[model samples]
Target: MTVEHREAAAQRQEAGAGGPQAAPGRRRVALLFPGQGAQQPGMALGLYRADPRFAARVDEVLALWGAEGRAVRRDWLAPDAPDVPLDDLRRAQPLLFAVDWALGRTVLDWGVRPDALLGHSVGEVAAAALAGVLTLAEAAAVMADRVHHLASAPPGGMLAVAGAPEQVAGLLGEGVVVGAVNGPRQVVVAGAEAPLAAAEARLRAAGLNTRRARTLSAFHSPVVAPAAALGLPVLRSVALRPPRLALHSGYTGGLLDAATAVDPGFWAGQPAAPVLFGPALDGLLAEGRWLLVEAGPAQGLTMLAKRHRAVASGDSAAVALLPARPGDDGREAAAAAAVRDRLAAEALLPV
Candidate 1:
């Protein structure tokens, strides 16, 4: 069966399990990682300085993968590099993963263990590692290989629409498909150049504001089908063990386990399938008020979380997006203090 069918099957199984489960208490929080466009120069500086060991950990992984750590370091250090195109898939994927993983480690150090993890687009690789499904080294290698595979294809792109996904789906028609529902009114669509343009026109005609994505690959659409085919074997080759925590499936809006996630086909299908973010957000809110930590490069996911909160009632819990860029300027202290204060105020953690 195709990845879409398989993911649909998985979601049906999860729904069969029962109604949405509730959180036992305030300990549950979801870490949401941003995808490609989120990367900015000088991101992750706070975490790197707060714990130099975070960068060391990334270095150790890159060394094992025969990858150069300096490239990633440069992006985090001088984000506005005039020479380097920050959005290049090869450069963008791994660098983004490293920054997110570092931020995740920093959060872990603060005694904040996520009850669940959700990553958008390329961020999923780092999420897998953070969830303990893959080692840091394994995560980095798989992501690098995946990006390299993507680079072989000609440049493609995705666009954002602010409207209900069903509405967007109806407007986009044949070529473009729903890539993600970042929030109630925020969705991403992907396809070939003409189809995407057509979809954007329709969306605007339908009164939905639109923005183009920075990604070169038309992710979550059939345009990446060729790339997904090439990456399937690599994804299968990687070992995916059980996660230490619950992981929400991006291809399906359900709680995913390692056994199901280990199928290389599952990972491969994601590139050409719409991310089930809207339903996933529904599942997340059913549990409890989530802190909604954006552990990746930019605040893109955080922006989504804010909109989700605005639309979804019973989601009154505050959401905080920690700074991903590294450097010293009291951000680390401030973020940690915020976490502590939130936890204390909610009695989730000791003061």
Candidate 2:
């Protein structure tokens, strides 16, 4: 095997900490969710029809969180909400979480329970809710409060890195750090503009590839330290439970226990920590077969899953790319239907 593959194997073996497993006779599957920048207009429309309970649960969450007033406007209920007022990060974070939560909840109500759950960046909040670590309302409230807290912090940004982790880390010496390792080489870095620029220059100098992320704020890096540090009170107020499923920590690929999982210090430190998406996938793969479901509005996680599968299988020919089109209901239905079909084909559903 290649050196990279060997490293991935090592990470799998070291991904210690046991979380809940799926019930007997049920094949292990993971429900993945995308974080910020994955939000699109009319995110919950498919679930709104595919499962009525999805809308009901979201309504319950809205009522419980006292955010019922900001419902997705009547016109925004279509497949795209480009004109809707989700421009503000404060509004967007909760809204995106709501959309992603609806997707996961509908899957559950439809009798498709995941063995584990993992969310990227802001999606981690939704994953916490799906794992029963946080209630829907509580997740929404914390996310809203988090966005509010982040806004007052100094400006910073995230950039996507298309290289190995060690190499990327080498390029970012002082301030910038890896935010999310979405795939083998698809990683993100966060830091202030100057540091990020320097890191980018160094990476390019080394012939490494990079792309600036769509995010306006630098999250999961030291840039968010001040904001997260000051937001301790809010984090402490949110009651968190030990995840009932294998909810991999974004800060590390290892599983989290109740004491550390629910601690405010953990969340506070997350902004400055490296995201272990690739390692988390390795840990999941080490267990058994898996049919990854992107339980969110966008297909970013799906894309990442495809990348990992290709890397693991070492057969690009065996991979399939499913793209989600903008403002297309038939496309959404087809995609969800395909997901259902694939889950059954893989015997991932409880018979």
lDDT agreement with native, every candidate? 0.69, 0.67
Quality of model 2 by C-alpha lDDT: 0.67
In model 1, what lDDT does residue 128 have?
A: 83
In the order shown, what is each candidate's alpha-carbon RMSD?
5.4, 5.5
Residue-wise C-alpha lDDT for candidate 1, range 103-144, written one tens digit per residue: 667667666656678877777777888777888877776777
lDDT of 2 by residue, 195-248 (tens): 889998999899988888766677778777787677677778878788766676
Where model 2 places Cα greater than 4 Å from the true spot, the runs are 1-27, 41-51, 62-88, 309-323
Cα misplacement distance, residue 132 of candidate 1 (Å): 2.0
- Backbone steric clashes in candidate 1, count: 12
